[model samples]
Target: MRVDDFCDYDNSFPDEFYACLPRECPDCGAPMEMSEALTQLHCSNPKCPSKVVQRMVAMAADLGVKDLGEARATKLVSEFGLDNPLLLFSYEPDKDGVPEGMSFDVANGIVSQLNAKRRMTLAEYVKLAHLPFIQTSSQALFGGYDTLDEAYAALEEGGLGYVCRKLDISADSDVSVRAARVYETLKMFKSDLYQCIDFVEIIKMHSAEMVHLTAVCSDEVGFPFKTKADFYATVNNLYQNLHVEFLGALTRNCDYLVWAGADGSPARLTNKVKKARAYNEKYEEHKASGTLKEGEHEIKIVSAKQFLYILEQLVK
Candidate 1:
């Protein structure tokens, strides 16, 4: 009983339906992809009015710009014609175009607040990438990734391309496109952001266990492990890029002191080996004497392959 089945069907419905269909974005013209039902349409275009506000909210949080909510961002765009988030730093307010029932000075204060927070540390800025490559939901970005400078090198060396290809997200994909916009927005304020970043700071884990890797058993025939560097690299791999900082001298705060080969052929003891032996001797004495301090972890000593075996159980 539908009009499409009739012989003299009217084509007006098709034209009206096409005109009113919410299939594409109003601002950027990208197709609207809904989660479940087609009863509503949300813009995936990063530059679109709605999506821009969402990014602004996240960017504001990253920059520590308080009191600037999504509603305020939307109002600034829809009412005052201020669309780009970076424009807030230099937004000039006048007698008109302010939100309804809000004074121009109050609006100006909001802009001032955002401008005040334009500067953030390089660590804070890099964390805003929210890329698929790094785990975003934890402190792993700073603790697990290499030094900030080295991490930047990895990013420049096709890390981003790797993520895009792995996810099958072309450079033009919506989320990737939005990530590009976020990058540009930060770039616009790069000078200020860089001013606040401490170039010499190095991020590390909470308290890493240190060990010694001697070349004593490195070249021994029939040995499972190869060289000292190979041993160091294996332990470093377990930590996922955190340097082991092999104890070459006395360290006051060492958590572990693994002997390269406790049962190997006799070898000369350097200052580092002497320190490890002395520390463990004292540790064993204190433990037997029942004088071990509360909340203190005893230093451990194991062979090269034994250390690797212990780490193998923990790496995953």
Candidate 2:
């Protein structure tokens, strides 16, 4: 039987199997610990050479810097004595010597690629930082804040409990543990990390004024307006005080979905309508279960006439 199958069936490994396994990491001589799920053993030392090289390669890829594979990353780490992956951003081709056997052109090219990606969105920076269990879509963590310092302040002030409450994550969930770990990691290294990058800006998709009251004007026929531009012009001219922002596409943040079709007797269900309805149905379920988070607004489908009337009432 296979070793995996034997382990699954027996629920314990043979004494010989345990004896054969290394108690310490072979590369760094650090203690080896089982992963949280007990799936595999890993080096306890975060500063292990192997780990540093792997992190550099991963960070390069995450930051959209090309050609910095394992081989190149290993050489850079060894040649420059890089302690952290973030140090890769501070590489200066003119000041720092290129790794032996690597041409100046190649080194310059890599530096140029890194320079090109200096400015990044907060979500992208989080992914590049390789925070534990955090994905590229870190909007849940950094959405409301405009700057990293603001988000970090919130994290520090609220602690893990605040993060759990903000994200609607259960305190006992694995995600909460990961969130805490991420918070600790950020606290320890956020300054160094932020200093390495040129710019880290949070791009808010919807403004606070329009976040809960935004609408999308679909391009379906039968509306009184000739084009979307005409509709926008009329709305801006008449409802200037309402501050109603119109989107070109349906998004989860959108509050109102206005189409050209008549209410109750619709001509066709366009993709925008379908998406809006799907979002509404999902939010309705969340609302029923009382699991809806703040800003989780439902989309209200309305005809062009109803949209104008709603705006008029709001303006009044």
Q: Output the number of the TM-score-best candidate.
A: 2
Q: What TM-score, to 2 decimals, does candidate 2 have?
A: 0.58
Per residue, candidate 1 scores C-alpha lDDT tens digits across 1-316 of 2122221343545576544556667766776654333344566554576665665666555444556688777877667554444445455676355777556777777666554443322343444432222324213223345345543444445454534543345776677853444334433434433442342233243336422222222222123544453344334445432334443344536654555445564544455566666766777788899988764444555566666666666554
Q: After superposition, how far is residue 106 of candidate 1 from its true place, in Å?
A: 1.5
Say what the RMSD of model 1 is: 18.6
What's the residue-level lDDT of 249 in candidate 2? 81
- The predictions' CA RMSDs to the true structure, in order, are 18.6, 11.8
Q: What 10-residue stretch in candidate 2 is worst by lDDT? A: 203-212
* Candidate 2 structure quality by residue, lDDT tens digits, 1-316: 2233333455476768765656678877877766546567777776677777898888776554667899998899888877677787778878988999888898898887665555444554666666545553255776665467777888888998877776677899777876676666667667756776553332343344432257886665346755564454345445324444566688999878877664764557789988988998999999999999888988988877788888778756
Between which residue pairs do clashes occur in model 1? none
